[model samples]
Target: MDDQSPPRKGCCSLRCGLALLLHFCNVSMMSQRACLSLTMVAMVNATDAQGLPNASTQEPPGDLRNPVYNWSPKIQGLILSSITYGMLVAQVPVGYLSGIYPIKNMVGSGLLLSSLLSLLLPLAAGAGASLVLACRVAQGLSQGTVLVAQHTVWTRWAPPAERGRLTSMSLSGLMLGPSVALFATGHICQALGWPVVFYIFGACGCALSLSWFVLFYDDPKDHPCISLGEKELITASLPEQVGSGGKSVPIKAVLTSLPVWAISLSCFAYSWTNHIMFLYLPTFISYRLRVDVRENGLLSALPHLCSWLLSILAGHAADGLLARKRLSLIAIRKLFTTLGLLLPALLVMGLLYLGSGFRGTLSLLTLTSATLGFCTAGMMINPLDIAPRYYGFLKGLTILIGMTGGLTSSTLAGIILNQDPVSSWFKIFFLMAAINVTSLVFYLIFAKAEIQDWATEKQHTRL
Candidate 1:
């Protein structure tokens, strides 16, 4: 009879545990789906802005004479890549402002401004490179502001156990934009002039802004649709918010933190690798593979589309590992961070040394591109790990540092190609590989997601 009682109790415990997990899984799936839907919309918006068609309806731009993408590849790359420069300059201010103002308000304002600016882009293009750059700068700054706020809001709403999936779901925008843009832009450029793309994007941006304002709230407490029990769970699960009176973190402390530096360095590496792929891959396909414009666009998108799928898988894996509590934080971070960089570097290097034909180069490039999805694990969650209270500010700092990779890479690629187009690409690939590897070293040595004792003590002092 005593043995029977013990078995009954154990059965009850197992049932309760399963019930709790199922509930968490349901909530997490709902949250992730919302984020994923948002990402899909954002990607469509970004793609249209980059002069892409709405979907698969149009053809890629071609010269009346040649009937292929007519814009100078280099100049087109410049047009696409210029946004990062504005984004970098805007991040710090955006971060600081978000801490003082409500995150929802910041996003609302950014979307409004971006919608207006995006409308002006088609008109601005005929004004020359300066005007185009000006519009891009405005768009980039607005996007940066919105993104800082978005990060802050996600941290507040997402549960601890579900953050990885939520973060990756949101970040799917990053990959989705490039994939959709490459495919659609080629068609849009073919069907209408590239300018028409901006008109479509601007109109869509306006619509999205309306939805965002209507649907989004800064905190779960403020969300009318949110359940009281879920709200309680979120608030209780979070570590206490840091700093004084909800004030911005001191710029100096953030600048000096070793962990921050590591995160920033890793971000730079990731950005360098990513932008190289985004900005150059199409041209590489056109020039090296001798593929037609439409085929090139479709092929280029394949790697990023693959990456988008893999990132979601990686996010779930991260959460499952956490739930099991089998790996130390350091081990977990190192596993993802190292593989993310090292594998891509190796693949890129192999392409440089051994790639001979179109098939070989494409295969190597795809593999390199796919490995980047692995970095989503560390990149998505590190902010919460190190300073959950200040995720927005940290993301701002990281973006400021990381986006330099675009400015430098574009400038350097231009310089190198000026001297010799073919040989220069090889050198650039090697350099990218080296940067990726060096960043891994920094991450392994110093990057940590755990809140520091000093930050915790500061929180107490504020209280």
Candidate 2:
């Protein structure tokens, strides 16, 4: 068995199980992340046209009758954006650590810690806005490790040919989290109170942490239950440099790599649009469409669900194309990246003209999100292609840079919406389109899918 060997046959492969568990890990993290977006709606006291509390505003269906705060738009923005701030601080360090430590411990402990924090979120909300912001930041810090660790895991488990599907399946949980959270949060708040949303998701995270500890091993060779054949297939499929085991990161080389920067920039562009949708789509539906909370939850979930499904399909498509030799790896990466960014850019712009037509707006947004799925086959997985041995460090570094987009988008969107929730949306949409186009051009110019020379053991030894 070697990199060029035919694909393994089996539906019950251990690597697939790894992907499945990683998917659940992602789902748990994302559900916690999305809880605040819709829960905030219920947490805040309804305001009138003049920015004063309006007791007459009708409560949405399933009112939990929880206490509401009067936090301003700017403050709410700070709270929503607070998680990214923590993520920025933790990403690189955790990424570097993933290469050195047992991934099961790092991921399991982080998620467990985050889950515990989620249980405190309702209490924090009751104390003050500042406490809530701090709590969210802590959650962000804990959850940050999960993403980098996921890439690190695949660096060991995924063969080159199966990389697209495996990584995409795991990554799809990013979208699934929101889809499930948004749909459930509204209903949960209505039936069980807003606090229950955090409690429920938090418990799920704790259980997932336990499962990861019991079942996951950092390397296939270390897993007691993986079959000999499946282990050999995974081990042989990885590049020699990666299979040789972890080495010190080539810091200078990674810093100067254009492909690395290209991936980071594309991630930034993608995160900008994604964070806005995740954190604010419910708000947009509430303000623009005047939908009730139940409808808002369902509507907000639509785009993310579409994205989840499309990412899986796109992953398979990318692998299929590679198997058929229909295009070079670079060509497939570029083509899919183009579809992901360009189509979303155009469709987001289309939102500016839709006014209050719920159907049209949702349609464009769903299409936009669905197109973003293509990136799972593009730059999202390119880190593995270019530097499988250093994937943890690269994933961390790139995502640290990329998450700034989330920080920037959330903060700026908050400021913009603070001015006039109605008119300010146009600026947000236009700005999103502009950023997407700019990043897509840069990625097209610099991105490469081949393993870099510096990523090889010989180059690493020289460094």
Candidate 3:
């Protein structure tokens, strides 16, 4: 996997970075949209009347308190939870189609549609909760293809040895996206209004969409900005995967493959803890540990920051190991992914013993995110390892699978946190630990780096 020459300077890599930055912007908007409760809590919680926070003392609807959509906990949860439904229904189909169309078109055009949907949120909310739910779901449908579309670009853009770094770099946007959402939404809510959150982010998405189509090409050979020599390098680097972009996907084989299942389930386990902690950590810090709500808000950001920094670090390290030939790809992926899962599991286990030592628990919780991020090198990059050409579909499948785990974890959190006992919280953390262990076992047993036969042009459709 060693390269004949060092990677070309400031061509595809730069374009890749900018494309992913746009992707992160869309993700940030979605995360902000889902957690409308947080940014608009000031407006919504103005009265005790059905979840409004004293609308009488606060300014009128158009005056001081505005984001009145999330006025009830039930409606807020439903509105927040509805986007996943769209993604669940759309991802597999979209993943398949991304290979057939220009990936830039898929990403750029799709994201613009989602942004436009964001612009409609206020109107939708003004109409009714059902209208708002429909709007969010439509946005999710537009974005459901994003995972596949992003990975499809990487097939042509990233070399085998370089994929660990490049894919990680691109995918790390997942972390950076929410981090931006959390920070940006907070400031905008205070300065402008809750409705402006949708407007501003939606406008940014449209802007990024224009740049994406203008700056990127699905294949290096197709990029006007790329040099002949750089195009030659990329073309030569991905010999097996070249020209596989338009090949038909072998759906039956994909659905039945064992390695696919292993990776997908492993991803499920990782997503479970990650999303649950992200959604509930603030509540745990504020209510369980009795930290002031304002301080808890700031502290909740620590885990995401840790994951973002660690993921970038792990990406470089993984690529370096691949280039130096110090370890096999399987070994390197296992090492990184196992650390991502096992270390966090151990930390969660430790939380059970901390009792009420709130400071220690917060520190451990933040540390868990850093370890969880090691998956960027491990399972996150596995799609490229197994089938570079079909990476979009494989990656989409893994994410689709992970959504189930996310739902399960979220449900468990709702039940346990509602019960509100230190011991009940302990059981949930222990469950997260056990799930991580199960994923490690599955990955160790079944994961593979070699391309699956069904994805090969010559040997496709075995199923």
lDDT of each: 0.64, 0.84, 0.71
Which 10 consecutive positions of candidate 1 have the poorest summed lDDT?
29-38
Please report how far candidate 3 places residue 86 from its true position, in Å: 1.3
Give the better candidate number (1 or 3) by lDDT.
3
lDDT of 1 by residue, 314-403 (tens): 777887787799776656666777877899899998987895787898889888888888777775468768776667777888877888
In the range 298-411, model 2's lDDT, one tens digit per residue, is: 999999999999999889999999999999999999998999989999998888876558688879878887788889999999988888777888889889888999789988
Winning candidate number (TM-score): 2
Instruction: Give each prediction's root-mean-square deviation over alpha carbons.
Output: 8.8, 3.4, 3.8
Candidate 3, residues 1-463, lDDT tens digits: the string is: 2223455653345445654565465455455444453454544543432343456444455563354433565455566667767777777777667767788888888778878887787778778889888987887777776655777777777767677666666666676655555555556666677778777777877777777778877777776666566667778878876534457677788878888888998889998888767666755665557643235545666776777778878988998898899999999988998999999999988877766586787789888877888999998888778877677777778888887787678766666654655577778888999999999999999988888887676855521
Instruction: Give candidate 1 regions above 4 Å deviation.
Output: 1-78, 241-245, 457-463
- Candidate 1 is scored at a TM of 0.81
Off by over 4 Å in 3: 1-7, 10-37, 46-70, 243-246, 289-296, 355-358, 419-424
Screening candidate 3 with a backbone cut-off below 3 angstroms (N, C-alpha, C), the clashing residue pairs are 45-53, 46-53, 46-54, 47-52, 47-53, 47-54
Pairs in clash, predicted candidate 2: 62-190
Which prediction has more favorable TM-score, 1 or 2? 2
Candidate 3 residue 101 C-alpha distance from true site, Å: 1.0
Please estimate how well model 2 matches the true structure, expressed as its whole-model Cα lDDT: 0.84
